[model samples]
Target: MAGSKTATLYRMVMPDHLCPSGLKAKWLLEREGYTVEDHPLRTREETEAFKAKHEVSYTPQAWIGDKRIGGYTELRKHFGRKQLEKGETTYRPVIALFTMTLLMALAAAWVATGEPLTILSAEWFVSFSMCVLAFLKVRDVESFSTMFLNYDLLARRWVPYGYIYPFAEGLAGVLMTAKILPWISVPVALFIGTVGAVSVIKAVYIDKRAIKCACVGGDSNVPLGFVSLTENLFMIGMGLWMGFNAFA
Candidate 1:
């Protein structure tokens, strides 16, 4: 009797009644043979505690038997359904647009500073590189396999991290350009470096077989070996230098 089948599912969800995804998941589970019992939980602390006790996190988590499935998207996979895919056309066109916008913004800064093109600072270069990388990532996500892989560990982490990385880079760029908040830039830079470094380690050691970069919104190439390491080290060096000069 220790391994008898159970007909119930326990879901601890962020009680956002307006989320279409959450509603969709609830509907889907009910449609299946599941008796869904939902508990509303908010705040990171509560989420973490629940996860610690139940071994799950992220919104719309599903439990079948003792196994926990995190997020609405993952739940869909377990039930043999496809998750929503980002349209290729929708993402591809925006890449060019954002690239042009970033270039224009950088040009404006260059003109305002009256600094020669050759005199661009490390922060400016790093910021521009990140913007370019982000653009590329967006394009990469449009491919089919990138959008559909079920057990993408790197993608899981990278997608969330990607949301905040751009803002950090942009803020550092602004600080460097305006010649303000020098002290803060160092820590900011270091933070960026640390994230990149951690990302590489996760990709290589922890998620080696998990094919997909997940750095962009969609699935793309798995950045492995030297490629991941080099990218992180470059960022780390940029951050440390930015921090050092800010203090200097």
Candidate 2:
């Protein structure tokens, strides 16, 4: 018997819990009218074999019509060329963790110096507040799945970005708290804040329409507008704090 109309297969091997870009690609592909066969490769051997066969080493290795598109950016470009687009959303986990770490660092610094009115204290308060907001905005895994399903968005594409953002933030916090990389903390914090601000602004620009936020996991249902605004404000405040300290 001939294969059914949905016989087309698009393969994707995403690292576990780290595949925002890959997810976005998958979402876009399905939206563009394609069947996607997604598998999360957990082991290094699995990743290597897949890469050797496909001539690519990446979380989101896409095979469409005998052509392999490596990585989220490539998939994005491919989807764009086809004139099929989904709303761009920032990865939440990473942003949240990053914000959390920054806040923790500030709090620690304040404790160490015993100065509640110092720049470090201000930074701590700001970071703490943003972290709280980030946590509040987190979307549950189920909601994330739903958002992608509704929009044909991929899980791999945006998930990794979300993971990375927080990983950086957390790492910076550890460094700051441990005094292992004290010299770099302020600069790194400033950079993170700037990048975050820019990212939020870009999201607002890309999707002018009000949409459901996949910020936290699926559990939290917040409007995108408020989340975006809050994110921007937090980042801006962090940036300003960092700049003020640097110049002072």
Candidate 3:
């Protein structure tokens, strides 16, 4: 057993670049009630020498007593946390976006209807989430379109559709939220949502192809699977409900 809670950290802190992993490692050590002895390699030569001596290729190495805890990732494993592997599929981005939009929708409902829980709240949640998702895609349309072409049948068939998708999604969402122009919004939402659902199902379930989702954004690590399906399903449900009310 270790005598005391002490950790030694070696990280890079160059004049031009401060390593993020190093800062994270230091923070993690402190959070775990360890007194950290931080060693900063301030130069490239120092970094190289340290790497050679330790026979390691990465920075932010930690040591607890005589046991080498490796890098920030290894430190996380030591603390019983799962570190995300490179290129690993994850639902974190979609989960975060939906969770945030849910809160925002509840807040909007409270302010507008004087009640947080209502049918309108659910509608606003889907509408607001769609708008936010569209914003992320349009933020870097080039990158989003490129990634979207990977699995989107419409985008693959007609490349221009990729560029128009974000704007169309945003317009439908805005109209739905304001409860106006159901004729326009309903059809638009239904079309895109149906297409997206089909594309995702074919790519993931039928083809069994591993891919990243462009639902949240281009740079997102969200896996192309259930969350994408859910997003499309929400839009479909909202469109159907709005259409029924508009025509009925």
**Highest lDDT model number:** 3
The lDDT for every candidate, in the order shown, is: 0.55, 0.53, 0.94
Ranking by lDDT: 3, 1, 2
lDDT (Cα, tens digit) per residue for candidate 2, span 102-185: 666566766788654566655565555444444433324344455423221223345544434443444544444343444465
For candidate 1, write residues 74-147 as lDDT tens digits.
77888889655543222333345445545655676577676524335444555555555555454544442244
Number of backbone-clashing residue pairs for each candidate, in the order shown: 3, 32, 0
Q: Between which residue pairs do clashes occur in model 1?
A: 141-218, 146-219, 186-243
Worst lDDT 10-window in candidate 1: 1-10
- Order of candidates by TM-score, top first? 3, 1, 2
Looking at model 2, report the run of 10 residues with the lowest lDDT sum: 1-10
The number of the candidate with the highest TM-score is 3
Tens-digit lDDT string for candidate 3 (21-124): 99999999898889899999999999999999999999988999989999888999999998788888788877888899999999999999999999989999
lDDT of the structure predicted as candidate 1: 0.55
